[model samples]
Target: MSDVASQAGRVIDAGAIRAGTSNAPGKTAWRIAWGVALVVFVMLWLFGKPVAGWAFDVPRAWRIPVQRWISDAMKWLVDDASFGLFSFTDLTRFLATLVEVPYRLVLGLLSTGIMDGRGSSAQEILPPLSWLAVIGVVALMGYFAGGRRLAFIVGGCFVFLAVFGQWDSAMVTLASILIAVPIGVVGGLLLGLAAFRWRAVDIALRPLLDLMQTVPVFAYLVPILFLFGFGPTSAIVATIVYALPPMTRISLLALKGVPDEVHELGRMTGCSRRQMTWRILVPSAMPGLMIGVNQVIMLSLNMVIIASMIGAGGLGFDVLAALRRLDIGAGFEAGLAIVALAIALDRLSQAFAARRPEHVAAGAGEKNLLARHPYTVAGLALIVAGGLAGLVAAPLQSYPEALQISTGTLGSDLVSWININFFDQLEAVKNALLLNVLIPVKRFLTSLPWVGVTGLLALAGLRLGGWRLALLVSVLSCLIAFTGQWEKAMITVYLCGISVVIASLVGIPIGVLAAGRERLWKFVELVVDTLQTLPSFVYLMPAVMLFRVGDFTAMIAVVAYAVAPAIRYTAYGLRRVDPQLVEAGVVAGATPWQLLTKIRLKLALPEILLGVNQTVMLALSMLVITALVGTRDLGQEVYIALTKADTGRGLVAGLSVAFIAIIADRLISAGANRIRARLGLPEGEGGHR
Candidate 1:
C-alpha cells in the first residue's frame, strides 16, 4: 500500500490532482441550476402561460420609452420649420426632380422616350454610340489601375454586355449599383469604427450586425419600403442592410489586425491616438478595408434583384418579369447582364486596390497633353468619340435596330423543353424525398414537447461549456417558444437541421480528400470562393424548377449555400493536424485509412464541428431566400409581413429566427471549443473553429 501510494504521488502532485477535480462540484451545481431554470421556462411557455412576463417585460420597460423618444426626435428633425419640415415630401420629390434632368438630357440626345417613360409596348431603344466607345471607357479605367491584360479583360466585359443586347438595362443596373454601394461602404465604416471605439456601442451594435447578416433579405424590404415607399431609396436601403455587415466586420478585423510594432512606431513618432489611427492604422488596414468595399459592391449588386421585388426597377425587375412570363431568353439575358456587372465591379475593385505608387521619369511633369496621364487623356478621347458616333448614328434608323439584339423565342423554347423533358422526373423525385425523408424528420421535431427539446439543448450546452452558455441557449430557445411562433421556428430549425446534416455528409469527405495535397486544397478553396460569391437567388431558380416550391427545394438550396464553410474549415483542420503524429503512425505500420481515421481525423474533429457551426449559420441565412418556395416557417411570416408592411410582425418573426441562430451559434461554438481543447489543438491556431 505504501509503495502504491508513493507511485501515485510520483505520478501527480496531490495539490495539482485536487485542483483538477475542484471544477466538478461547481460545474455540477451550475448544471443543476440550468436544468431547473430551463424546466420552469419551458413549463411557462408550453402551458400557454404569460412567458412574456419574463421574456419581454424587461425589454419593454426599457424599450418603449426609448423608442418614443426616438420617434419624437425624428419628428422634430423632419419638422423643423427652418429646415422646410412642413414640406418633407420635397426631400424625395427634389431628388426625383434632379434625376429627371439627366433623364431628359439622355432621352433628348437619343430621341427615345423609354429612358424615363413607362410603356408595355416593346420598342428598340439602343444607345446612340457604338459598343466600341463603351469598351474604350472600360479599358481606360482598367489601364489606369493595372496594365494591358486587365484593360482587355475589363473592356471585354462591356463588349460582351453590348453584343448580348443588354446595354440599356445594364447601364440602369450600373447606375443603381454605383449609387447604392458607396452609401453602404461609408455607413459600414462609420458604424464599424464606432463599434471599435466604444465597448457598450459594440455590444449594442453586434446584434444588429448579426440580424442584418443572418435574417433573410426579404424581411428587411417591408421596413425599408414602408420608410422609403418602394423605389430606388427602398432598394438602396435593403442593399445597405445586406452589404453593411461584411464591411463592418472587415473594418473591425483590419483595425484590430494593425501590428503592435506599427502602433509603437506611431506613438514614438509623437503622433496622437487620433492621428496614429488615421494615418498609420487606417492606411495599414486599407487593403483589407478595400476588400470589404469590394464585397459590399458585389452584395449590393446581388440585392438589386431581390430589391426589385419591392418595386426597385432595374435588371432584377426585368429578370423577374421575364421569369414570371416564362421568357427564358429574356431571363437569361438579364441574368447575364447581372453577371457582367458583378464581374466588372469585382475586377475594377480588385485592380484599384492592387494599384501601387509608380516612378515618374525625370522632367515628366513638363510633358502634358496626352503624355503626362495616359488614362485620363484616353478617357476624354473616348467620351468625345462616343459623342461624335452618337451624332453620326442619329440619322440612320437601321443602326439602332441592328444594335439591339434579343434572345427572341429561344429562352422560352428552351424552358419549354426543360419543363417537358425534366420537370416531371424532378417532381417525382422531390415528392418522394419530401414525403419519405423531410416530412418524417420535421414531424419528429414538432412531435417533441417544447420542454424536452429545451432541456436537452440546455443540457448539451452545460456539458459543452459551463452555466453561462447553457443559460443563453435556454433563454434563446424559451424566447422563440414564448413569441408564439414556436411551431414555425421548429419548422425552420428542422430545415436547418437537414441542411447541416447534408452539408456534413458531403463536406467532410471533400475536405479530407483536398487536405491530402496543397494544390488540391487550393483548388477546393477556389470552389468555395465561387460558391460564396454566386448570388443565393441564382441558386433559387434551379431549385424551384427542380423541387417546385416546397420544403425540399428550400433544404436543397440551404445545403448548397451552407456547405462552403464546412468544406473550408474541415480541410483547414485536417491539413493543420500535426505532421509528426501522422509520421509516428506511419512508422507503426498503420495503413493510410487507419492513420487518417485515428490520427489526422481525430485532430480534425474540432474543426469539423466548427464547420457544423457555419453550416447552421449559412442555413439560417438561406431561410429568407428559401421562403420564396413557400415554406411555413418564421421566414414565411417575415415575407408575408413585408408584403403587408407590418413592422411589428416582421421584427418579431425576424428576431425569432435570429435568436434561434444565435442560440445554435453559441451552443455549437462552445461545443467545438471544448472538443478542440480536449484534442490539444493550440490556441488561436484554427480559423473558424
Candidate 2:
C-alpha cells in the first residue's frame, strides 16, 4: 500500500512538471505583449487625430536630416577626399579606364570592327565576327554542352536576333554580359573562398551580402555614377556589383557542403592548404560553383538592361528609348530580343552547370586535338571560314536590311485594333479591380497611424522571435518614419501587399493542382522557367498595353512578375510532404481532399509561408521597376532621385525599401521557424532561421 501511494505521488509530480513546462513564463510574457499592442493599436485608430498629430506622421522639425548629411558626405568624397597617393577622381578614372579596356575589346570583337585613329580618321582594321559565324559557334557550344535539342533552341534564338534586325544591339548586350559575368564570378569566388575559410569573415560578410542583394539596382547606379562617371564602364561596374552576391553566397555554401571524406583525404595526403582548396575542395564543389556562374550570367543580363540608363547601351537602350517615347511596338520588339538572348544564355549556362565528365577509355588522351575536341575545332573552323567569307560576301558579314523583318507597325496596329474593339471591356475590368480592391487597401494602409503600426510589427517580431528581432524590426521601421518617408513607405506596402495576396491566391491553387499532376507540373515548370528568365522590364510592356499607366497597371506588373515564386514554392512544398503521412491518411479512410487539407497542408505550412515571404520580396523588387509606369510610392522616389542625380535621396529611399523587405523577411521567417519547431521539424531551412 505504501509503495502504491509513492508511485501515484511520482506520477502526479511528473504531470505537474509537464504542465509547468507547457505554460512557460516566456509564452505568458509574449501573450501580454501582444494584448498590449492590440489595445494600443485600437486606441490609436479610435483617437488618432485627438491623441497627437505626431502619432500619424513625424513632424518636419522632428524628421532626421539624413538626406542632407548623406549628400554632404557624397560631395566631400567626390570633391575633396583622396588617398595620399591619388585623389578620389583620379582613382575613379583609373578604375573606369581599367574596366573600359576589356569592354572595348569585347565590343570591338563582337559588334564594332577594331578601329584605328580618331572619329573621321578612324579606319576599320579588322572586321567583327560575322553574325552567321557567331550563331554557328553558339549552336556548336549548345550541342556540346547539352544536346541537339538545346542546339536547335539556342540556334533558333540567335537566328531570330539577326532576322529581326537586332543583331548589332544583341551583340553589344552579349559583349557587356561576357565582360561582366567573368569579373563578377572571379571576384565573388575569391570573396566566398575567404568567407568560407574564416569564421570571422563569414560573420562580417553576412549582413553586407544581405544589404547588397536587398538594395535596389537603381541605388547601386547612383553611387557608381557619382564615382565612376556615366558610361558603359560605370554600367559594367554596377552590373558586377549587382550580380556578385549570389555567386559569393553559392560558392561559400558549395565549399562548406563538400564531403567530410574529401577533406579527410586531402589532410591524410599531406596536401598544403592551397593545394587542398584548389585541387580537391574546389573540384568537388564544381557543380555548385557552376550554379553560381549561371546566376552571375543571368543577373548580369538583368542589370545590363537597367544599367543602360547610365549609358551601357544595347538592346536595353533600345527598349528604354522606346518606352520613353511610348512606342509600344518598338519596345515589344526590343524586349523580345532581350528575352531570346536571356533564354539562350540561361539554357547554355544551365546545361554547362549540369554537365559531368565522360569516362575516358585507355589511350583516349593520346588522340589529336581535332579528335579529342571536335566541337572546339569545328567552332574555330566556322569562325575562320565565316570571317574569310565576310571579306568576299556582304551577306556573310552582316544580315542584309532587305531580309530583316520589322513587325513594329503590325504590332502597333494590332494593339490599336484591340483597344478600338475592346476598350470598354478592358476599362471595366481595370476599374473594377481598382475600385473594389486596390484603392481601398491603399487607403487603409496609408491611413494607419505610424506609431501604432510600428508597435504592432514589433510585438509580432517579439512573439515570433525574441527581443533582439523585435528591436531590429522596430529600429528599421522607425527609420522610415524618422526620414519623413512614412506615407510613401505605406504606399509601397499597400501596392506590394495587395500584389502578393493576389499572386498567392492565384498561384497556390495552380501549384496545388500542379503538385498532384506530373504533366501539369512539367508544363508549369517550363512556363515558370521561361517567365523567370525574362527581365522584369518585359512584364511591364504587356501590362502597360492592357491597362495603361496607373496603380492598377503597376499592380498587374508586380503580380505577374512575383507570381512565379508563389507557384514554384507552393508546388515544391506540397511535393516535399512525406508520403507516409498521405498513406496513413488513406488508411484512416481520408479522401484525397481531406488528406491534402488535413495532413499535407498542415505539414507544408512552413514552406508555404516561406513562399509567401519570397513572393513579398519579389513583389517589392518589381514595384521599383513599375515606377517607370506611374506609381507614387518609394519606387517613384528612387526613380526621381535617379533622374535628378540626387545620391542622398536615392540611397535613403532605397534603404527605406530595403528596410521594408528586411522586416517582412524577418517576421515571416520567424513565424515559419516557430511552426517548424512545433511540428518537430528541423529549422534553418529558410530566412534567418
The segments of candidate 2 whose C-alpha lies over 4 angstroms from its true place after superposition are 1-32, 357-374, 685-689
Please give the range of 10 consecutive residues that has the lowest summed lDDT in model 1: 10-19
lDDT of 1 by residue, 70-170 (tens): 33544553455244463654564575555445544443333343343456654545444444565777888887787888888888777677777776666
Cα lDDT of candidate 1 equals: 0.73
Q: Which residue pairs in candidate 2 have backbone atoms (N, alpha carbon, C) closer than 3 angstroms, thus clashing? A: 684-689
Tens-digit lDDT string for candidate 2 (339-408): 8998899899999989997888899899999989898899999999999999999999999999999886
Question: Which regions of candidate 1 deviate over 4 angstroms?
Answer: 1-130, 264-274, 326-329, 359-372, 394-428, 514-530, 575-581, 684-689
lDDT, residue 136, candidate 1: 79
**C-alpha local distance difference test of each model:** 0.73, 0.87
- Highest TM-score model number: 2
